[model samples]
Target: MPTPIIIDCDPGHDDAIAILLALAHPGELDIRGITTVGGNQILDKITDNALKILSFVNADIPVAKGAAAPLLGKLVTGEEAHGESGMDGPALPASKFKPVEQGAVEFMLEIIRASEEKITLVPTAPLTNIALLITAYPEVKERIEKISLMGGGLAYGNVTRTAEFNIYVDPEAARIVFESGIPIVMSGLDVTDKAAIFEEEIQELKTRGPVSVMVGELLDFYSIYGKKMGFVGNALHDPCAIAWLLHPELFESEHLYVTVETEGKLTRGMTVADRRKKPDQPANTEVLLGVDREAFIKLLFDSLERLDRQLGSPAGES
Candidate 1:
């Protein structure tokens, strides 16, 4: 049986690829729906980008818009990275899928309550939407199998000198999710940065076939922003969470007690993972520490190629 999952994202460039990966690996994952949050850009843009990307892949997943900001703090958008449109890569055809009226949090609760099997929550953006769902409907907590989120870092940070973008955007929400007692598998920058998507791979994506070509164009557009950020290459951040579902062996993780800094002015949104020597806090998350980049990228590109070959064009491809 395929693992049923719900992707909560902000449609960052890598988020686009994450959707494609989920669509490609049908047996490994059953996407219940897509929920958009405001992190990379804003609620409207992220929702639009979610539909656009899924449509691009010809995936028929429903989409819902979530919170426009965090639980208590002002929403800090990542215009520097994802651009004004959230997903600024290749010209995506206009989205044919409109967002449902229930909103992301409600939609998440509805599906989990209705499904007989537990649903995995893969949150690749800020935790606002996920946190909201858990808080608004505490009864559904038992229905959630786990939350696989892409944020925080064991070592470095991108948004601040100590925090990653997703968590940094909404530290309070992150704090709630960490303390919510649901099992979490955190695919932070610690592992994601290790899985860099570089130029050679991009070339392969371009010439490997037509589907590869589309992925290549998306990456090409994605890379321009990366170059400006001194990445020298792209980090498959969002996709790492989806990849975790398909290929868990590519990454190394440790069971640890993880908490979010919600009130500290200097460390807000920072994941306070207790990687300490002989600690007493109950470990709640499997925090990924490293990844086999070569294998990881190979899986991604190959999967996209497979989808392209099968469908000929993205579902929304004109």
Candidate 2:
């Protein structure tokens, strides 16, 4: 049987591709639901983007909207990176699918409680929803198999000198999750920055099929932000989380005690990974430190090609 999982995300351009990749591999992943939280944009916009991606893929997974802001801070969006419409570039039609009437926290609770097997969680946005779920229902912790999240950085930060965007957006939520003691696999910048999609690769993807073309367009727009920062291509951030689930061998990780800094003036949101193996700090996170870039990209391209074959022509092409 496929590994049952839930995807909690804010549909940034990369998040859109991650959804497609997850949906493409039904044989490998039985996606139970998609939950949206506020990060790349507001709750409404991100949720709408999630609906749009699911609609484009003709997927039937349930989506539920979660927190609009962090537990204790004002909502901050990465408009400069993702554009005004969190998922810019793709001339996507309006979403036809509707999210579940129940809130995201409730949806998570129901799914976990009802499932006979432990479910994996792939969180590609801020940790708000995951934190809320844990806080509201402490019993559900035992039901989670693992949390593969795209956030944090072991080295330099993307948002600030000491913080990554996702965790920085909601350090409090991240703290709650890190301290909850659930198994965690963090695909932080240490690995994601290496999962870069270059211009030539984008052009090649466009020829693969309609879905690939749409993904190429999304990456094209997403790459602009990275170029400005002197990067060769855009980092496939969210997809790295999913990729870890699909092919753990493609990544090299370290077991460490990771904690989120929610109260540091200069280091708020910084993921303090205890690499030194301090006696008091028990290892809490499997922090991905390296990735085989070639294998990672190949996995993405192959998955997209498979999706293209399965879904037929891209929407509006026929």
TM-score, every prediction: 0.94, 0.97
lDDT of 2 by residue, 1-318 (tens): 899999999999989989988987888899999999999998999999999988877787899999999999699899999988898998998888999999999999999999999999999999999999999999999999999999999897899999999999999999999999899999999999988888999988877677888899999899999999999877999999999888999999999999999889999999998778678778999999899999989988888877777687642343
Span of 10 residues, lowest total lDDT, candidate 2: 309-318
Task: Say which candidate scores most in TM-score.
Answer: 2
Worst 10 residues of 1 by lDDT: 309-318
User: Which parts of model 2 are misplaced by more than 4 Å?
Assistant: 314-318
What are the lDDT scores of the predictions, listed in order? Answer: 0.85, 0.91
Error of 2 at 227 (Å): 0.8
Could you give candidate 1's per-residue lDDT for residues 111-137 as a string of tens digits? 998899999999999999988888889
